[model samples]
Target: MKAMVYRGPYKVRVEEKDMPAIEHPNDAIVKVQRAAICGSDLHLYHGMMPGTRVGMTFGHEFIGVVEQVGPSVQNLKPGDRVMVPFNVYCGSCYFCARGLYSNCHNVNPNATAVGGIYGYSHTCGGYDGGQAEFVRVPFADVGPSIIPDGIDDDDALLMTDALATGYFGAQLGDIVEGDTVAVFGAGPVGLFAAKSAWLMGAGRVIVIDHLEYRLEKARSFAHAETVNFAEHDDVVVHMKKTTDYLGADVAIDAVGAEADGNFLQHVTGAKLKLQGGSPVALNWAIDSVRKGGTISVMGAYGPIFSAVKFGDAVNKGLTLRMNQCPVKRQWPRLFEHIRNGYLKPSDIITHRIPLEHIAEGYHIFSAKLDNCIKPVIVPNAG
Candidate 1:
């Protein structure tokens, strides 16, 4: 097997590795067909997240065929094509029973918060991820579902993380009909959230980003207004002005650790590792939104303290909702939306690289070169 192993910051290579085998009674080994490099993976690539050990594979958005399943895995068989959610959890746990699969208590002994996430880091559970020819899925019955008849593999791959998380972010917004929704960041999650806001009856959807290419995607794919924060003197004031001075009814933060617009924050958080993650995006969400509006954060941040505007959020009476996104929970509506031609999740996929070229893919995506939006890894490609 060949897997993308993390050597150090900005260093990764596809190296020959031992094939995974079923390690638990409820485990299953999947032969990966399609996998995606998520925005969150950049955190590990840049060495921002703690406990990301060298030699660990970093990928969570993946879909594949089951190679083998343990005796206890009754929901799936060896030949089933499955779209595994990023979460690795036991379905019967207290959190899982409440549809909070991302916070399952039975997995990730290191976490008192988020549950097991494949390939994230030791902090989220040190399980190797699917950025390879194969991966081992624990609690297989609870996490993966068979790819539906009409769904494309690329679409299935995005559903595992980006699409699901973005949809969950919109759901958290609790958007009333005709409300104004402003999304921070124009990455996959932000794009999807902007698109989903329309489905949730938002009268106006605005996507904020520094990149014109992504803002263009927001206009075409999301049918929303675009805000290039780099062109503004103060993005918060610009957002307020754009929303008629009262501010947007809802604001969602989709840019996690490596947000731009603030050099000091980025240097301190993403570069110097002084804080968990740069709080620039979240602060923008707080400052740009209306006083009583909702702020939904779908961005991936470390499990450590961040320099956020908690006092301002309290003062404004904002409803801030966020989570790792119970991916499976969002699948039902998302599937319906995809089937009805309301969304083509793979529309955002700008690059597809072979497993061996994952390092180059990482470089292209990390550098934001070549208009790269999303990149998929084909592990079994010829």
Candidate 2:
């Protein structure tokens, strides 16, 4: 098997690796059909996530066919085509029973925060991801679901993480009919968040980003207004101006660790590693939303201190909701949305690369070259 192994910051390569096998009674070995490089993977690629060991593969969004399954796994068979959610969890746990699959207590040793995530890092349970020919899926009955008859493989792959997380972010917003929503960042997650806001009955949607290409996607794919924050003296002020000076009814921060706006914050958080992650986006969300409005955070941040505006949030009576997305929890509505032609997750996929060219794929995505919005890895591509 050939897998993308992380060597160091900004360094990865395709290397031959041993194939995975059923390690637990509930485990299933999957031959990966499609996998995606998520923006969160860039945190591990840039060595921002602690405990991201060298030689570990980094990927979480994937769809595959089961090659083998342990005896205890009864929900699926060897030949089932499935879309595995990014979460690795036991379904019977307290959190899982409550639909908080991302915080399942029985999976990760550090489950006090996030549950097992495929190919994230040792901090997230050290599970190998599906950026290769094959991957090991634990708790097979709970996570992976059969790909529906009409769902495209690329759509299924995005549903595993980006698409699901984006919808979850919108759900957290609790948008009322005719409310105005502003989304920070214009990546895949951001674009989906903006699009989902419309489905939730938001009267107005604004996507903020520094790149014009992504803003263009926001306008076309999301059919929302765009704000190039680089062109604004103060983005939060701009949000207020557009919202009639009261601020948006809701704000979603989809830019996680590497948010660029404040020089000092990015330097201390992203470059110097002094803090968990840059709090610029979250702060912008807080400032851009109305005093009593909601703010949803779908961005991936490390488990450490971030200088967020907690005091201001308290003062403004804002509802702050955030968590690693419970991917499977969002699938039912997502499937319906796709079937109704209301959503197409694959529309954001900009590049597809062979497994062997994964290093180049990483470079292109990390550099944001070629108008890259989303990149998929075809492990079995010829």
Candidate 3:
């Protein structure tokens, strides 16, 4: 099997590797069909995530055909086509029973905050991801669902992570009818978040980014207003002014870790690794929302200190909600939306690369070249 192997920071290449076999009674081996390079993957690629070791494959969003399943895996068979959520967890845990699958206590031995995630790092349970021809899925019966007949494979792939996380972000906002919502970042998650806000009855949606191409995508695909943070002297002030000086009813920070607005913050957080992640976008969210409004955080950040405005949030009585998304929890409603033509997750895909050229795919996406919004990997391309 060929898998993308992480070399040091800013380096990755395809290399032949041993195929994964079922190691647990509840495990399954999946032959990956379509896998996506998520925005969060860049964190591991750039050495922003600690414990991302060399020789580990990095990918979480994938749909595949089951090659083999253990005897205990009753819901899935050898021939089933399924979309596996990014989370790896046991079904009967206390957190899983409460629909907090991302925080399942039985999976990760390293930490209690985040459950096992495919290919994230040792901090995330050291589970290898699906960025290759085959991957091992633990607790297969609980995490994977057969792709329905009408859902496109690409759409199903996105549902594994990006699409589901975006919708979950919007749900955390608790948007009331006629409320104005502001979303920071225009990546796949942010674009989907902006689009999902409209479905939740937001009267207006605005997407903020520094890239013109992504802002253009947000305007056309999400049908939301756009703001280039680079063009403004103070983006939070601009957000406040746009929302009639009281600030938006809700604000979402979809840019995590690598947010680039303040020079010092990016240097200390992203370059020097002094802080867990840059809090520029999150601070902007806190400042851009109204005093009593809600702020939803869907961005990926490391488990460390960040210079967020916690005091200000308390002063303003803001409701701060954040967590790693419980991907399977959003599937039922998302299936209906995709079938009714209300949402098309595949429309955000801008590049598709063969598994052989995954290094180049990561480069293009990391560099933001070719106006790339999303890149899909084809493990068995002809």
Candidate 4:
């Protein structure tokens, strides 16, 4: 098997590796068909994620066919095409019972957090990821979802992470009919956030980003109104104007590190004197949200701390929800949506390359060049 092995910061190699085999009674071995790079993967690539040591397989979003399954896996079998959930969770945990699969204690028992992510790091359970020709999926009966007929691998790949995250974000933000929702960032998660907002009945969906190409794609595919953050020095003003000066009912932070700390500062009315360039969209979303509005943050974060405006958040009485998506809970609903054609998440796919050229795709996507929005890697391409 060949895989994109992470060597160190800003380095990856397409090298031969041993094929994975089923290790547990609940395990299944998937032949990787299509996998995509995620923004979170980039965080690891740039060494922003702590404890991500070298030589780990690096991918979390993918769809594949089940080449083999354990005897205990009754729901799924050989030849079943499935989408892999990024998080590895056992379905019987306390948190999983409460529909909080992301916080399942059974997966990441030793860590401060509860979730375990593939290809993330040793801290996230050190599970080998789906970036190779074959991946061993634990908890196969509970985790993998068989793709319905007529769905291609490219379209089903997002069910693993981005699309589900976006759906979870929108659901957490309480997007409803006649509500106005503002999504920060136009990256893959942000794009899906906008689409989820629209699908959940948001009357107006505004997507903010620096890239014109992404914003344009958001407008066309997500049915979102666009705000080019680079064009407007006062993003808050633009957001306010768009939302009738009352602020949006719900603001989702899909740009995590890019917007997290700044949003905290803005909502609390603190001084914006931070030296580093945090994603301004966070501040804009906080300032652009109405009093008592909801904010859902699904972006990845680092250990570095930034000042937040606790006072303003208190005064405004806003509700802040933050976490990784509980993919196990959301996967069923998302899959149904995809199967029914109500969600076309694959519209975000901007590039498709063979697994051999995955490094090149990474280069283009990491640099944000050539209108590259989301790139998929086909492992079996010959």
Candidate 5:
């Protein structure tokens, strides 16, 4: 099998690797049909995420066909199409029982707090990822959602991560009918966040980003109102004006570490004075949201922390929710939405490339070229 292996920072190589097999009674082996690069994967590429070992597989967003399943895996079988959740959780854990799949107590012994993630790092359990011809899915019954007949693999792929995260963000932010929502960033997750906000009955969905191309894509594809932060003299002012000076009822920081404040020099005027939040987009979203509003952060963050105005966060009585998405809790709902016509997450996918050309895909996506939103990699291409 040929798998994309993480060699080092800004380095990934397609290398021949052993094929995966059913490792546990509850496990299953999947032949990957489609996989996509995620913004969280960028954290690994840039060396910001810790514990990523050399030769480890590097993808978590994928949908595929089940090639084999262990005896205990009764619900799924050979030839079943499935989407694997990015977070691997034991369904029987204390946290999992409470619907907190991201904080499952039975996985990732090395995780600083709780929960585990696929292909994230050693700290999240050194499980090989699905960025290859095949992968072994532990806890298959709990992690792999069977794709319904007639659904395209590309469409189902979003359920693996981005769609679930977007839905989770909306759920955590307490987005209700008639609420105005502002989402920071226009990446795949951000786009979905905006879309989810609308589906969950938001009165208005405003997406903010520096890139005109992404904002445009969000507007056209997701029907979101976009704000081009790069063109605005004051983002908060622009947002306030858009929301009639009350600011948004709910704000989501989807850009995480990639925001302007992280690269301090990129920000101008008042933004320069702040130390920038650990996940900089959080601060940006916090400032842009109305008082007493809720802020949901679904962006990836590393161990190294940054500073934020704690006093302001407290003073405004803002409700801050942050962390990796609890895929187990959200996947079923997203899957149901996909099964119906309620959510079209596939609209965010802008490029499709063969696995052999993954390096090219990475280059173009990492450079944000050609208005790339999401790039899906087909592993068995000729």
Candidate 6:
């Protein structure tokens, strides 16, 4: 099997690796058909994630065909086409019982805060991801769901992470019918969050980003207003003025870890690795929302210190709710949205690359070249 193996920072290449086999009774071996390189994958690519070791695969958003399944995997079988959520968990765990699948206590011996994630790193659980011809899926009965007959594979793939997280962000916002929603970052999650806000009855939606292409996508794909923070002297002020000076009713930080804006924060957090992740976007979210409003954070950050405006959030009585999304929890409603043509997750896809060319795919996405918004990997490209 050929897999994308992490070398060092800023380095990755396709290499032949041994095919994975079922290792647990609830395990399944999936032949990856479609997989995506998520925005959060860049954090691991750039060495922003702790314990992202060399030779480890790095992909989480994938839909595949089951090649084999263990005896205990009753819900899935050979030849089933499935979309596996990023979270790997046991169905009966305490956290899983409460539908907190992302924080399942039975997986990831190395951490207590998060459940096992496919190919994220040792920090979550050292489970290999599906960026290859085949991947090993644990707890297969609980996490992998068959892709419904009418759903597109690409749509199912995005549902594994980006779209689901975005919907979760909007749900956390608790948006009132006429509330104005401000979303920071025009990445996939941000774009989806902006789009989902409208579904939740938001009166207005604004997407913030430094890139013109992404903001353009937000306008067309998400049907939201756009703001380029690079053009504004202060984005927080711009958000406030746009919302009639009281600030937006809700603000969401979808850009995590590698946010740019403050020179020192990016340097210390992203470059020097001194802080967990740059809090520029998050701080901007805190400052951009109205008092007593809600702020939803779906961005990925390291498990360390960040210079967020904790005191200010308290002063303003803001409700901050965030977690690694419980993806399967959002599936039922998301499926209905997709089926009704209210949302098309595949609309955000900009590039599709063969597994052999994934290193180039990562480079183009990281450099923001070719108007790249979302890139998918074809493991068995013809």
List per-prediction Cα lDDT, in the order shown: 0.92, 0.92, 0.92, 0.81, 0.81, 0.92
List TM-score per model, in order.
0.98, 0.98, 0.98, 0.91, 0.92, 0.98
Model 6 segments more than 4 A misplaced = 261-263, 304-306
Superposed by TM-score, candidate 2 places the C-alpha of residue 255 at a distance from the truth, in angstroms, of 0.7
Q: What is the model-wide C-alpha lDDT for candidate 3?
A: 0.92
**Given candidate 3, what's the lDDT at residue 330?**
98
TM-score result, candidate 3 = 0.98
Question: TM-score of model 2 relative to the true fold?
Answer: 0.98
Which lDDT tens digits does candidate 1 get at residues 115-136? 9999999999999999999999
Question: Per-residue alpha-carbon lDDT of model 4 for 1-382, expressed as tens digits?
Answer: 9999988767888998888887999999999999999988877776666667888998988878889988899989899889888988898887778877777788775586757887788778888888889998998988888887776777678878998898888988987798999999889899888898877889989898888999999988898898887788788887888777899999998886534344654333222322222445555666788999988888776543444555666788988888889886786677688878889888888898888887888888888889999998889763
Q: Compose the digit string of candidate 5's lDDT tens values, residues 1-382.
A: 9889888867887999999987789999999999999987876776666677999998889888899999999889998988888888998977888877888888788874658787888878888888899998999888788776756777778878898888888888898899999999889888888888877899989999889889898898779898888788888888888888888999998887556553542242123322212455677787888899999988876542456766778999999988788875776677678778888788888899888777888888888898888999899763
Q: Candidate 1: where is the Cα deviation over 4 Å?
A: 261-264, 303-306
Looking at model 3, the pairs that clash are: none
Quality of model 1 by C-alpha lDDT = 0.92
For candidate 2, lDDT tens digit of each residue in 248-274? 999999998878636776666667766
Q: Per-residue lDDT of 156-216 in model 6, one digit per residue for the tens? A: 9999999999999999999989899999999999999999999999999999999999999
